[model samples]
Target: MMMHRQYLIDQAIIARNILRVALPLQRLRASATRPTLPETPTRFAIIAGDVTDPSSSLGDLAMFSALMQSLRAQNPDSIFTIIGERRHTIVVPGIGETPVEPAWAGKTGTLAFDELIRQHHALFVMGADILDGKYGAALVQRIVAYCNHSVLLGIPATMLGFSFNRNPRAPAVHALSRLHPHVTVNIRDQPSLDRFTRIVGVLAQLCADSAFLMPSATDPITEPEAWIASMRQEGRTPVGINLNAHALAPAIAEVGMDQLIDHFAEQFKRAGEQNGLAFMLLPHDLKSQSGDVSMLQALDQALQRKGFTHVRYASIDQPDKIKRLIGLLDLAITGRMHLVIASLGSGTPTLSITYQDKFEGLYQHFELSLEHTITPMQCLTDELLRKINDAFMHRHDNRARILSHLPRVKALASQNLAIATCGHTD
Candidate 1:
């Protein structure tokens, strides 16, 4: 039954891709024969969280980068202004400065927040995190007061991948809806969309996660030679484990990272004793605050205690780290949404340890089995190992299934960019 469902989804995806390419080509040819259209300078204000904080913020930053690139390609005259943490300034070039602290507070710094909005035609407000009641309300009021168009690119209720334990600034969002008819709200998940529609009295448009648009390897990306060589020497199936121990969800705690790692380490150690394939711990978000590095270190220590010497760690700072990490994986079992996204994007089979609805939605979107993906809070190691083994056994089929959706994901992102920039009229 699952195979039949997957086949039907694949057929629909192929049909969608065919239409996307053909329709765009026809539009291009028609435009070419027409008189040249005058170029317009569209200023975009992307209200985002601090990029320096590499938690869920990385997903937003990556999306912003992709959107900026896409917009530049379509409209060279367009200018993008990012309002977030000042520390993020170094990573994103050409971003105009804004006061970082009290992000929700209205115009409490040297920068004239009101004046900046008056100059721009549209404001693209990211996740509701930036919309804390008083501060968010003030910011929204200022934007509505200044800009002709404003949109809240919210995470849809259907997108089960994001961590949404904290209730977003509903009062502020409500205020914006009441103040301006031009104000629009959209979410990434289906359930959120339904609830939002109930609150706002309007059906929100559902969109795919922006992370799908993240850039792939631009350079000669390859796995670390040292890591790959060491794996071959150990003769154990190289499995990448990304466990989110400090996750916001308490359910994740129930899984007990120590037990999870110990079981996998022992299993790999036994395999290594016979044939030599070692398990490698790959921490996706390894920053100090995220606590991924510390968690991995603890797991490393545990593995060492078990006499497992073939384990390796992938440094996040390394060049082409994402590509390198994904490439090295024979299989990936991860709790981080982006790691799963990256692995699937790179055609690497992955078993997702989901704590939120976003993971389930993504699996549904790609027509993958939810049974293969588990919630850590469940702590079913036997089931997890079975899923991991299944993923490896069906690695080729899974990769092909994931690859089939990439073109569609990219096309949807392009369509969203067009709507974000060109669809809004001043």
Candidate 2:
């Protein structure tokens, strides 16, 4: 039933593309409601994903924060308005919720949406991998429509740094291929660049992920700080673990969550004993379906049953706060890509539980080895313990490698900001 629904949706998208070319959209749009600009050149509209929602993934907030921070640094006089559904007030890290204008409610290709676009000098679609069509055809259509409408109205539009998966849906590829040449689309990694060019048949400039610019908290939270201090006092290395159900959906479906928790608990028990390591459970995503807190909590309980007292949960709400905690770790292991980004960006040795083929491109930016990543199936065996021990032993070398390549990656990340401010993909 689900596959049939997706097929019908894909067909609808293909039909929409044909109608887009056949219909006289320009004449129709010109006759629609027109809104005059406020003469504010710095006025910008940020769309896709609400940065102010408390329930949002910290990773999403991290990207939004990075974009906001970099934009402000490049142009401090910039005035901003979020263009999406209104969200509950959740303070952005290092950036409070009150300063920015409230979200303007208007869907793409509508008269109201057109009026709103005219008021802003520029429009930025926060693609962040959503344009790949895995989410749905509706989202892919909406983003592309928003960009098309913005460019037609003479306001510059830019699709911020995003990734294209190994196999993007044909409908998404078709929609993106129709984008105006004036619209600047930035693909984050080389593999995604290849995928985008092959499918969309358009030129997309390369840039690093924007989460690299996420600012760390001023100081570590008391709980994690105390845990780290105690571990060092006993001469044990602090290892941070971030696990999410989203990445291990297949494994959980096969072996159940309880068995998976038990498996990790047993491995951590043995590895900690042999390697003199203490563990920290770091939860990155907060959504119910893929939330990390519940899984990490269960693993913590299982670890306690095995008499491993060094394990603790770093319960930090803000992305920057958790990033600061990740920075303090001697080594980190995670299924969450943003957590891996935080660790590597902060010069900490890290291992990734590979998913979606996104990690290779990220690691390539650091010139690091793919040996640092493991599959979900590997987590079920003693191989997990072996990898942990190996990573722990080579922590210094990993940290040095990450630090050496940090600047170049950061500069590439900053290029996204330059693209936004300077209004060019080059």
Candidate 3:
């Protein structure tokens, strides 16, 4: 009987060891044939935000693209189990199999969390726009989930480069302090880094947004869209313009959003009449309910109503494709964060339409001149015309400046990914 009990204990310990190393094979759903691995395979979990959403911001796409590139490069042949909804699939270059269909998908939201603990080696909590503090409670909940699954369940959890910027901030910080002790927090901007360092003992390592790390995709839209063809036929230089939906929301704005839109239309109409400055009114995102397409259509109609026939709308969703499209432009004036990244990354002279501190941080990273960044509130004035014309006038020099800083920004972006995936213990 004692010998039998000893054998049972031995069995329990063996089971525990395996659970610590590999998630039970039965949990992971089978997919198309996978690449061969050694006797043992290492698996990492990437838990980012709702990147699959068609209307999702290009910034989110940019972040995910950079992350996957660096992670896959650093850990080739390692199994990647993406933790999120499995609705839409993003085709990352060189990935043979779908990174979805993980062991945890149906189990956590649909299946069970206890089932996931059985598979926990480590998890990367890659949030989307967490620093905006709009998702403070959501991020806190994620932190709690990570702590429960990792610390309590004996798995390592790491928080990648995210932001922490919220006003009336002190009361909101208690929850942030509750983040898993083992989790490494990598801040994306100097403001976030400074705030955390001063407020919390844990001064986060400052890193650039992952978007800067992404490579320009070779495949562009070969042909399509009547407006594009029409614009090309005009034989004038095509400049790209992107406006965010939220920035133009009537209810949200203190000023008359409609009037502002009209004013913008008039200014562009004036520019077009003066210099044949035609516009490719490109929408950066289409995922949100009031996404870029809605905003673009609204602005397009307003411009058309005012007799600005030179403005043509083009909606490109994929970041790579968008980058390629933006490259075709002589100049790009955009409010979309990733659009700006796309333009600058492609060595295209771009004007950044700033919405908040995020744009400031981004332009600062490349030491871009402040004159190039303008707020929507300021977009109604002569200042807008000056900035727009300046971009077109000094387009060549600006492109050179962007290219000069591209190497450094790329290095910082790569470093952000490195620290994020390194699983820092301290």
Candidate 4:
């Protein structure tokens, strides 16, 4: 059944790719003339990861927040605008809710998108796996088109901090290959760098995820903070656990959601009983269906049934708060990539449940071992239990390893911004 569903998705992607190439839109062609930078303050048109969604993943929000904050810090006088649906309002981390300009006034063509780009000095696309087409072909196609339009208009454009899997869509590679030299493509990890270069036949630049630059909350909130403090007082190590349903969909399909939940619950129960560790449920996504909240609730209920009161839910409203709280943990076991970033970037030990083959490259950035990551299939067995206890037992060493390589990793993340702006400060 899963294979059939995937086959249909692949067919849809192929159909869309054929149509995109066959029916080319007007003003979407390359231009021989190039435009120079303006003497006045630059206007940046941002293509954020998730700006308009109400139930946005805190990870996506964090990446967007970090990017915007970094840009503002570098160019304080520059004007910024997010290209998104005007109907939806976006709430950034430090800066509250913000309004956005519509990507299209009417039709889905280059005329309107180009007119929008012509108003800005440059275009910045936050490439957080959205360009891969495996997630959504239409989104990847639209962003690619926008980038092509921007570069053709003589404006600097960049697809920053992105990754590609082993088998990327051919259309995405083709589209990326045809981009103007004015447009820069920055791959987030080394594996993705090699994969992209091998497929596209272009030497794409390597960088780290933008979320690594996000600052943790200074004024900590209560609840989880107080709860973690209480656990420390009792001589227990606080461990943050994040399990997202979106990443585990394959595993859920293979077995069942309940069975998978039960498996994790049993393992966590054993870990708590044997190790005397306090657990915190840290949820990143708030979507009703595929979000982490439901899975977190299920785990909480299951553990509650087993009379495990040592476990508590982590506060997850703001990215900074959750990031700050995650930093307080002795260690973390997470499925979401952003959670792993937040954990490791904070110098906290993390054991990740990796998907998409992306984590291996991320761990490579930190000079950590692949043993730090496990697959969804491994979650069903004793491997997860063994890794959890093992990670906790060697928490200090893992923390040291993460901290040792954090400086270089952060410098790589900051490089994404410099490349995106074409080395222009103003």
Candidates 3 and 4 compared: the better one by TM-score is 4
Provide the lowest-lDDT 10-residue window in model 1: 152-161
Angstrom error of the Cα, residue 223, model 1: value is 7.0
Each model's TM-score? 0.69, 0.90, 0.76, 0.90
Candidate 4 positional error at 68, Å: 1.0
RMSD of each: 12.9, 3.6, 10.8, 3.9
lDDT of each: 0.51, 0.77, 0.61, 0.77
Model 3, TM vs. native? 0.76
lDDT for each residue of candidate 2 in 1-426, tens digit (9 for 90 to 100)? 998997887888767644542243354456755444444457777775533342367877787778777777767877666665543444667656723333332223343456566778888777676788877765576567767766666667888788889888868877888887878888778888888898789878998888899889887488788889899899988999988887887778879999999998999899999999899998888876775989999999999999999999877778898888888889998988888888888999888898777788888888788887888888888889989888888889989999999999888887676433222221
Per-residue lDDT of model 1, residues 46-72, tens digit only: 666432342243444455655565666
Error of 4 at 80 (Å): 2.2
- Pairs of colliding residues, candidate 3: 55-286, 55-287, 56-287, 106-111, 107-111, 107-112, 131-163
Task: Give every collision pair in model 4.
Answer: none
Off by over 4 Å in 1: 1-39, 50-57, 76-79, 85-88, 93-103, 106-111, 128-181, 184-186, 189-192, 198-200, 220-226, 229-237, 246-277, 318-320, 420-426
Error of 2 at 167 (Å): 1.3
Error (Å) of candidate 1 at residue 213 is 1.7
